[model samples]
Target: MGEVIRVAVVGKGGSGKSTVAGTLSRLVARQGRKTLALDSDPMPGLALSLGLGHITEPMLTAAVEKDLNGRWQLKKGIGGARAVSQFSIEGPDGVRFLQFGKADELGLGTMFASVSGFGQVVHRIAEDGVLSDWSIIGDLSAGTRQTAYDWAPYADTYLVVVEPTWKSVLTGRRIVRLAEQRGAEHIHLIANKIESNGDLDVIEERMDLAARCVISRDPMVTTADAAGVALIDHAPESSAVASIASLAEGLEGD
Candidate 1:
C-alpha cells in the first residue's frame, strides 16, 4: 500500500559512488521515508560513510549456494525482501544498511553470489512490490561488474556518479547505456567532487548525459573523512551536504 523506489548508485572507481549512495539514502530518510542502503560492493564502503560498521545478520549473498551439479542457486534464508529488517543494520535517521558478502580477495564466487542476490531483489520487488515504503539505494561494485553481472534491473533507477575525468565520464556513459539495455526505467547522472564551475563545465562539455544533481567539492567532506564521522552530522551546512540533501525532493518523482 506504499511506494518504494530502488536506486542503485554506480560509476568508475574513485568516482565517489559510495559517497553519493550513502548521502542520498540519509537525505531520503530525513524526509520521513524509510530507506535501505544496500551495499552490493564487495569492498563494502557505504557502511562507514553512513557512520556505521558491522552487520547484525547474515549477508544477502549468503543465501546463494552451490547445488550438487555445481550450479549456484538461492536457498531460502534471505528470501522475502519484505523482511529485510531481520537482516539489515539500522543507520542514521531512517536508513538501514545491508552488504553482500565481504571478499578477502577478488574472485568469481563473491561476484556471482552478489549478482544472484540482486536478481532475487528484482524478482521479489517486481512480483509483489513487497518492499513498500522503503527506498532502496544500492552502492554497486565499481566499473562493469554490474554490467558483467547483468544487475541493472535490481534498481528501478540508477544514479551514475560522474566526476571530472575522462575515465569517469566514459564509464558513466557505458553504465547509462548498459542499464537502459537491461531495462532500467531511469538512469540519471550525479556529478560529484566538483571543485569549481570549471570542473562542472568539463563534465557538461564532453558528456551527452546531463547531471541531475551536482555535489560540490567541500573541505568539510575531507575533514569528515579523516575524522571518520558522518558528513551530515559532522558538517550539516557544508556545500556537499546541502547539494545532496536537495536531491531528496525529486527522488521518487521520476
Candidate 2:
C-alpha cells in the first residue's frame, strides 16, 4: 500500500526459491524500481545466485540481535533510523542487498532463532520506511516451518516457486496454506525448471494455486551458476530471464 512492495519467496528445499528471489529482484530493478533483496535464509543462496558472493559481514547483525532481545531503543527518530540505513548494501545492479549469514546448527539450536533476528531486521526496515521507495524481496528458507512465523507477516505478496515434480507441488501447496495463515494478501505460484508447456499445465492442475509464470529449464542458468554470476547479468536474453521479467510486471499490476 505504501511505496515499497514487499515480496517473499517460499517453497521446499532445492525448489529454486532463491533463484526466483534473485531473478525477481533484478526484474524489479530493470523496471526502474529501487529494490532490496533480503537474504533471510541462514544458508543463503541469494547472494551467490545474484553473483554478490558470500558476504560474511552483514551490516546490522548485532543491531538485529539487540532488537530481537528488545534491548535496542526505538526512539522517535534516532537509533532505529540510523540502524536501518547502516544495515543495507548496494549491489552492482543498484539493488540493495542484505544477508543473515549461514545458520550454524550446532551453535544455534534452531533456524527459528536466526529468523527471529531476521524478522526484527525486516521489521525495522519496513517501519523506518528507508526502503519505502523500493521493493523488498525476501529470499526465505525452504519450507514454511523455518521462516513462516517470522517473515510471512511482512510480505505483501508471496511468490512460491515450485518445479513440476510431485514433491515440489506438494510443497507449494503447503507454503500457500502457510502464507494464507500468515495474512499474506496476494499469493502466486511459479513453475520453474519447466520442460514444456505441458509441464506448466500439469503444475496448474496438480496445485491449487494461481499460476502466474512458468520458466522453462535454461542451460544458461546452469552456466551462470557455475560461473558465479547473476543470471540476468550473465544471460539477459535467456528465456528464463524473460519469464521472470513478465512475472515482475504481473506483480506490479496486481
Candidate whose lDDT is highest:
1
TM-score of each: 0.85, 0.85
Candidate 1 lDDT score at position 77: 55
Candidate 2's residue-wise lDDT over 79-151, tens digit each? 4336446666777677878765466532442344344445666776656555557687888888877455656
lDDT of 1: 0.74
Model 2 alpha-carbon miss at residue 133, Å: 2.2
For model 1, name the residue pairs that clash. Answer: none
Range of the 10 consecutive residues with the lowest summed lDDT in candidate 1: 53-62
Q: For candidate 2, what is the TM-score?
A: 0.85
Q: How far is candidate 2 from the true structure (C-alpha RMSD, Å)?
A: 3.6
Name the regions of candidate 2 deviating beyond 4 angstroms.
1-4, 64-81, 104-116, 126-130
State the lDDT of candidate 1 residue by residue for 194-254, as single tens digits.
9889888888776677778998877887887777677777888888888887776667577
